[model samples]
Target: MIPAEDRAEAGRPPARVRHRRVFYVPGYDPRSPRTYFLLFSRELRKFAALHGITARMRAGKEDPATSWHVTADWPGGPVKTTVDCLSWHEIAVRDFAVPKWRVALLSLRVLWDAVWTGTVWRMLRLNWKFGIFSLYPWGMALLYALAALGLVAACLTLAGAVGLPRLAGLAPAALGLYGLLRLTEILDRRFFVWYLINDWIFTWRHRTRRDPEADARFESFARRVADAAEDPSLDEVLVIGHSSGSFVSISIVARARELMREVEGRPRLALMTVGGNTPIAVAGRQPSPARAAMQALVTDGGMLWVDYFAPQDVLNFPWLEPVAAFRLDLGGKPPRNPSVRSARFREIFSEERYAEMAYRFYELHFQFLRANDRHGEYEFYRFLAGPEPLESVTREPG
Candidate 1:
């Protein structure tokens, strides 16, 4: 049932005003030690205006203590709603136009790990190849382990020696331990450097920083949404998951479904997983908790589940028969001289229906939140649901 507030303004035709409160979940820890590329409600406001959808967007930091809310009017008037961003991590993970962003983050993370690992190996290699222990693997292992233990001992001895009258004696002992610990930390940093430069550290940091007991934490947020949308008539509480947040989205939906079941007006939900990372999460021996949770949502809740992928966004998984596949040119419009922009998207989007919907408004994953659209097409943001006739809207300043 439409809200009485919305019903009061329902007379407009071409502008079917309805509330679609979008929750933009940042891909990883929205914030980290380094610079964070933020996604703002203002961007959403712009898209809402273009679509004639009025929206008030609220953004939140990665801090679990905060909340995000948005209410807006569009396509004419008086559509109101609040979006909870902190709680929408799951929806962000599950639905969106492009899955590649998540993939890119994960892939870059893996590559970064590989780089750091390579660095450590190189540092260790020098000793293994030409240092005093070069000839004997077994001997080197024994010596290194012993030396590591000695380093620890020396530090303790140094601390004990610190208050003693012999400062000179303490210096030698402290030096050995300090050098070893410093070396270890340097090697660790070396291992992580690749990710640091590329901005992929955000993913690792968020994952590592998340609590060991994450369920209660996630369940708390899910309950809040369930409580707020308690009125049974709120259509299907559809959840949209995008990029890495897909990991969180699946978990919440499953938990929310269970929690709401006891309520008389439990919501029927549709889990839309866009540019997701389910496959990535499940690629190894045992599926990650996030992947397992996603599967549970589908099996237990009987939720309407759909997944979207874009081939051009090298970051998506190679899952066959995805619910939808979008064809976007991450490469700027196929050379203007050859009418590349017109030809490329048409060629790629023509063969498949899901791809067509997915590609309707193609924005490169990285460029989605950016204001500057170098290729003239907002791409992803412009076609959130798909492309619409924009010629008329473009003529009028919206």
Candidate 2:
């Protein structure tokens, strides 16, 4: 069983953390790091008030991304954390910069590849809601396209009925259709059609050897984690990756392990991924370095990975067990590294609060990173800027 890999020494909880280093890799979002700084800083205040503790965050160098310091005095003890958020918004904006028409065409091609290659069916079998979510943007794109074509046909018919030359309506019909298509683009801001398209395109490209430069960037993040791990004063080097950022975190942690020289007295190195389903990037027949990295970390005994899975969230795959789903070749090692834990969100929020955000999928998907209404076992902000070491917080199954 996977639990066997983490038993005994490998699963032993580290000492209560005093000084910690936190690395955050946000999802494929183009928002500025200042936004995340505000999100976390505000949430820290809410957490302190709820727990009746003292906690504060001060911004550090915050240009490309934010570097901040957090000090929290929980009932257990006082702890200080240095938090660094890796920024890739410039790269994301480049992906966003693709011509809208090209994004649609590329998205169609990518979607077709997934369906033609049985990727969609595979994903549906894994988690139906997530499969539907994957198809949501393209489905809307097709709907709007059909609406435009039907309007053009109606315009042409009206012209012919009035006894004008059928071609007489061509100019007006073309203009009307163009206006309708432009309206579709305007609607995209509300639906995030092109934005989701860019995310899938990036994921497809990253795993298919089209985004080697991103890997080059990931290596720097890995080196940073490795550097933090070797620092004896820090109790833990914790990396948190959410959404597609999970894709990068998996590879970086694996690469960091490779970069780290075997040494005694190193701080515990750990990872937490929220919103599962990242395996889509590397789940095909073709071998990929990302897939290889996943296997190494899942089977490795040195580090801990807790996949925070929220079943009600439609944006992520539910019930994903990578070792079983990906058919990772364990090579006789116990599958113990990733302790999949259910994020009991319903319990964290009051019934009214839960119902209010239940339909807001994006808000729910992001709840993993925010402070809960009630202090539950999964106090994310507490675990993040904390006296609690990752190992101790995640050692027991939730």
Which predicted model would earn the best TM-score?
2
1-398 in candidate 1: lDDT tens per residue?
11112211211111221332333334443243122212544465555655565555444456423344445443344444334454323322232222433533554455455344442233233223221211122243235458866766665666667674444455666567567645643653433222222223333332333333445656775776566434554333445456665656766666665676445544334444555434333322332455345445433313344444444443333242211111112233211100001112323233453343453322333332432212233233332222221221122211
Clashing pairs in 2: 2-335
Each candidate structure's TM-score, on Cα atoms with residue i matched to residue i, is: 0.46, 0.93
Candidate 2's residue-wise lDDT over 1-398, tens digit each?
A: 24633533543456688888999998888888888999999999998888888999988755435789999997778889999898677668888777777887888778877776667777777777888888898788888788877887888888899998777778888899788867876886778777788888888887776886777788898999998988878888889988988878998899999999766777888888888568567666566677888888887778888788788898877666787777788799876567778788888878887898799888888888888898787878877776777766666656
Find the candidate with the highest lDDT and give its number.
2
Q: Which lDDT values do the candidates have, in the order given? A: 0.39, 0.80
**Model 2 alpha-carbon miss at residue 374, Å:** 1.1
The deviation in Å at residue 206 for candidate 1 is: 11
Instruction: List candidate 1 segments past 4 Å from native.
Output: 1-24, 30-38, 52-66, 87-213, 262-268, 300-302, 318-363, 367-398
True-structure Cα RMSD, model 1: 15.6
